[model samples]
Target chain A: MSTATTHTSAVVHPEYDRLALNRFGLWLFFFSESLIFLILLLTRFYLFGTSRPEELNQTLGLAITVILLLSSFTAYRAETAIAHDDRPQFLRNLLATILLGTLFLLGVVLVEWPEAPRLGIVPQEGFGIAFFSMTGMHAFHVLSGVLLLLMVYLNGRRGAYSSDSYWGVEASIKYWHFVDVVWVFFYPALYLL
Target chain B: MEAKKAAKLRLGWIVIGILAVLTAVEFWVAIAINSALLYLAVLALAKAALIVQYFMHVNQLWHKEGHE
Candidate 1:
């Protein structure tokens, strides 16, 4: 019995090891990606020194920030639902997240972009440059995040994940939250600070 | 198991609630205060921590456990 127990304990679970490794790899990727955003943030502070143009839309800024935060909540719900094998809730929350993310993108591209230039914060100079680049880069991530969530939603509809297997959902949701975390910093940097 | 997962979902709701409140206060401070840089920065970091810990489940990276 002792020998049998030792053998059982020594047996390697490749799936568990792979899961741990994947988590580590994703976090490393986040660290690297963070460097890029950090540089952009530093550049903004260097040039603008916390001075924003009077024409910037503070209301719309808060609106989009709220939307992004709400999407992160939905994304978390989706991941949790899938982990518990609740497919319907998973799909529902994923769709919600996707819609909110798309709405955030539109708020930036359609409303904020045009309003900025019309209000004299053009992208060519002054606060406008930092505003566009920061929001532009963040908007690009939101676009990609929406696309990623879309793919996950589609796959989920086809019965792709279960309680025992939900790495895809978890990873995508983590990325979604990471995007939200970035905005948590970016919002104040651009509008509030 | 389902109950546990539901509890986790509820925790998410709670965290989001805190985050919303912090954001609202951050907005108010930005509008009300003149030199609000330090206050805004602290609020931002608090929001980010709530996200990374509760929403992102950064603790999972270290533990050999199932999803919480």
Candidate 2:
């Protein structure tokens, strides 16, 4: 009976299943958050049209957007490696993701944002205020994702996960990827668009 | 079991590729038509759907048999 129970539990308690459930809850939360952003995005578009694109700082912005998108791929690879118990590959991918996310944030703060004053658009300006608020909120999400990834990395180093029990890491990856998804749109809308 | 897991990962990469292509197309349309505003909004929703279905495995979760 004990052996039978072990076999059944092994099948029923696959780590991926638990990870999926956690991610489901997280996605619901994200969906709600996205609705708010969506409304904000629409408002921004209504207020500023194609002419606003000319006002954006595009070069550095597009570069950082590419970085964030690539980071999502790295995070995806890391989760896949973790699912297969490939520790070395998982760590490498996760580290790459962290670096890319950080670079993305830095690009925003140091490079793209400084031009607001030069463009005669202070944060107090209507368009400037909306643009910064929306993208700034998205950046905050990215920062939170970075912190989560750090925790996942530390826990992974401690062997807190395995091929059979990695719900935490999986959930972290999901959240990180969601942040990436949000930025993909935010970048083009706020900068290139 | 391992093979099934590997297949899932492959499926994920395929979805990612499709997303990349869609994004490229959106970028192209934005450039050609000079209307990044509307195109960006639509592309954002597509990208969100891809992440939700492929990366987050929302479809699998919804199909799950029971709730614990």
Candidate 3:
């Protein structure tokens, strides 16, 4: 009897199965979010054609892209650290991600917005509306992502996760990467192409 | 197990390096090959796959017999 139960249990990992369900739900959320971004992207092409405002800063656009990409890397590092039960490394990387993400947002809200004329964002036209709306939505996602990371970091600080169970970390990271992926498209649409 | 985990961590850095190089290429294409929208689109898809397949762990999504 004991052997039978042990054999059955050995072939099954219910915790992981549950985690997979959560992952599924998150992916569904991402799919829906993609629809929203798709419309924004389409609007970019429809409104601006192949040309962007001549005033846009290619350098700042690239800088923000690099920052967001580096933040994605740090988020990956944090996830990997937590997977190995390295709480300190996880915390450090999480902080770095938050800082980098916030910097990206500030670059948009503070510097980028103020330099609208130079960036070719005319508030009175379709160009301004589409450009700001696109970046603003992405910035909002980044803000939510930063909040999510902070929540995960707080829980992680209390030793809420371990090598065997770190679904919170996993969930946060997938979403963060999605935000980065969105920017990968948005950067070119708004600044360069 | 430990060795495999270490390799996985190193893979993260490898993926990041690839992404950086691709981004540089994107910038070059944007400035130099201004008419190459299709090329940019393809590069964007490739960059997306790298992140999704690796960082997002999409490969871990399915399993047949094993519950884990």
Task: Tell me the whole-model lDDT of each prediction, alpha carbons only.
Answer: 0.90, 0.76, 0.86
Candidate 3 structure quality by residue, lDDT tens digits, B18-44: 999999998899889868678778888
**lDDT (C-alpha) at residue A34 in model 1:** 89
* Residue range A49-100, candidate 3, lDDT tens digits: 8887777878889999999999999999888887777789999999999899
Interface C-alpha root-mean-square deviation, candidates in order: 1.5, 4.2, 2.5
Q: Rank the candidates by TM-score, best first.
A: 1, 3, 2
RMSD from true fold, candidate 1: 2.2
Candidate 3 all-Cα RMSD: 3.1
- DockQ, prediction 1: 0.74
Interface RMSD of 1: 1.5
- Model 2: runs farther than 4 Å from truth? A1-21, A49-53, B1-13, B36-38, B65-68
CAPRI docking class of candidate 2? acceptable
Top candidate on lDDT is: 1
Candidate 1 per-residue lDDT, tens place, A1-193, comes to 9998877765766677788888999999889988988888999999989888766789999999999999999999988888888899999999999999999999999999989888999889988888899999889988888998898899899998898888888888899999999999999999987
Candidate 1 whole-model C-alpha lDDT, 0 to 1: 0.90
Per-residue lDDT tens digits of candidate 2, residues A63-178? 78678877887888888888778788889889999999999988877766787768866678767877788878888888999999999998888878777677788778888877
Given the true complex, what DockQ would model 3 score?
0.49
Can you give the lDDT of residue A60 in candidate 2? Answer: 73
What's the C-alpha lDDT at position B31 in model 2?
Answer: 66
* TM-score (all chains, Cα) for each model: 0.95, 0.83, 0.91
